[model samples]
Target: MTVMTTHLESETAEIKRRRDPFLIILWLVLVVFALLWVAPIVLIAFTALKSNAEIMATNAFTPPETVAWSNFSGAWERGNFATTFQNSVIITVIKVPLGLMFSAMAAYALARIKLRFGKLLLLFFLFGAMIPFQVMLAPIFTLVNGFGLIDTYPGVILPYLAFGVPYQVFILHGFFKAVPKELSEAALIDGASHLTVFRRIFLPISLPVLAALLILDFVSTWNEFAMALVLLQDRNMWTLPLGLMSFQGQFSTDYGQLNAAIAMTVFPAVVVYMIFQRYFVSGLTSGAVKG
Candidate 1:
């Protein structure tokens, strides 16, 4: 009994020793990663505080003597961020939900229902995802213009939905397949219609996937420049990205103000990701593994 207990104690100590080194290495790696990720943002913040002269003279690594709270306000007003922000909000609000619903519905149909040409339909959507956005730009522009949608909100927004839906459908099909069939069947037996089952059972259980897609779509739509640039010719209808580009001129650049504007453009998306981060990871992993 004493010998056996001693051996067990020795094994436990060895396990701890092995785990301790791994833990230390993991912490060190995470610390390095965090610094690398954070360094650029920190530099941007620092530059935003400095005057143009200071920014040009000093090393970017150096900290400013004082925080320039006014830089944010100036960037907001001068950059026409108010209008840009509203444009982004309107586009995102309309596109994100529409994209999610359409994609989710398509994914559910593909994953759950038996239909003629279902595999072909899914393959078509996947093929759409593989097509480069640049290749379709000319055709999309012509389509939007033929409908007289150029320089219009719907022109930019509708094209976004059309392009974004395929990938969203692709991701969500995996998630839908991962959902247990019994729950859906049980709902059906309870006299729940397909719509009702989707609303109550599938949606509630699939919140993580939904949340993940929302963030992903929001980020993509918010940062989108090419389509917004080509479609929206009117300055009044400019998104944040298009508006930020206005700061650059042929003569000279305002480095301090430009960096501040760039930072402002990135801030909202970062806040959103931080808020929904947990669901984002869970949804992505769950879909990938289970599908």
Candidate 2:
């Protein structure tokens, strides 16, 4: 019994010793990555607080003697963030729901339905994923212009939908395909119509994927600049990204104000991610496992 206990104790100590090195290495790697990731944000925060003169005089690595709380307020007003924020909200509200619905419906059909050309359609959308946004800009702009949608919200929203839909479809299709067909068949046997099965059965099981896709789509639409710049010619219709660009001029740049504006622009996305992070993580994990 004494010899057996000694052997087990030695084995346990060996296992712990082996684990310690890996744990130390992992923690060191994480710390280095954290510092690298956080460095830019730290710099942005410091720059936002400093006056232009102070920024020029002092090393950017050093913190300001006094935090410029007013920079945020000033940037807010100067950037016309109130109006730009409203525009972003409107575009997001309209585009996100519509995009999700269309993408989900298309994905469901492609995944579940039996059709001669369904695979072909899926391949076509996959091809779209490989095409760069810049490649389609000219043709897309011309088409929007021909439709008299220039300088309008629809002009920008429509293009966003067109570009965003293919990706949404691709992601959701994999998720939908992974869902057990037994549940769907059982629902149909219970006299549930196709629409009812989709709404009541498929949707509930697919919430994780849906939530993940919504967050992804919202972030993309919120940060999108190129389409907004090209489509929205009017100041009133300009989204936050386009409005923020107005802060830069030929003569001089408001570095403090620009940093402040950037911080604010980034704030909403951060807040949204925080709020939905739990669901986002769970959904992504679940989708990956199931898919």
Candidate 3:
């Protein structure tokens, strides 16, 4: 009994000695980052509740003496959020799913199906991902103008879909490629067509990745600015970013209302992330490692 107790105590000491300092450093780093990220958001919330006069007098981090609840309503009305919010919602709702579907289909073809010149096509997509959107702005504008799509949702939506697909396809392709070949082979042996396999097997199993992409694509669509600014000439057709831009005038800016609008703009995305966050980490890391 004495010898057994000594061995058990030695094992506990060994385990304690083996505890990595790297984990402690990692957690400390994570906590610091978490606080860093949360600070700006908290500051924005604080500023949003202040009056413009109060904002001008006090520093950004200072809290309001009294919560100015009207700032939210004022932001909604003054920013023309009613119209801009609808336009943003319309673009995001239409663009994200369509982009995901198209990306997923392309990824499936590239990763699962044996296609002619598949490597070349993938390289083409990767090249497209590297090309900056700023470089394409002139050509895209001209193309949209030629199609008479300017001042239209299709104008902006089409461009968004095109730009977003390359990266999304890149992400989904990796995840799809990592799927077990045996699973696909078994399905094929059971008389399942490629399309059937994709729809039934791949799609169901890829929910985490799909949800992750959906959230990412949704936020990108929601916050898109430059293309929307150029394509959507009509004021009523403006999206949230454009609407937010209106807060800054040549001579004067409404900081409080601007911050309020910002808070509101960020709210939907926060809600979306919260809802889909469970799948986010898993989805991103899906194909990162292999046994």
TM-score of each candidate? 0.88, 0.87, 0.86
Per-residue lDDT of 19 in model 3: 74
**Candidates ranked by lDDT, best first?**
3, 1, 2
Model 2 per-residue lDDT tens digits across residues 101-155: 9988888889988889999999998777778797777888899999999988898
Whole-model lDDT, model 3: 0.85
Every candidate's CA RMSD: 5.6, 5.8, 6.2
lDDT by residue for model 1 (93-139), tens = 89999989998888888988888999999999989888878777888
Ranking by TM-score: 1, 2, 3
Selected candidate, larger TM-score, 1 vs 3:
1
Please give the distance, in angstroms, between residue 73's alpha carbon in candidate 2 and its true position after superposition. Answer: 1.8
- TM-score for candidate 3, please give it: 0.86
Model 2 spans with C-alpha error above 4 angstroms? 1-19, 53-58, 250-252, 288-291
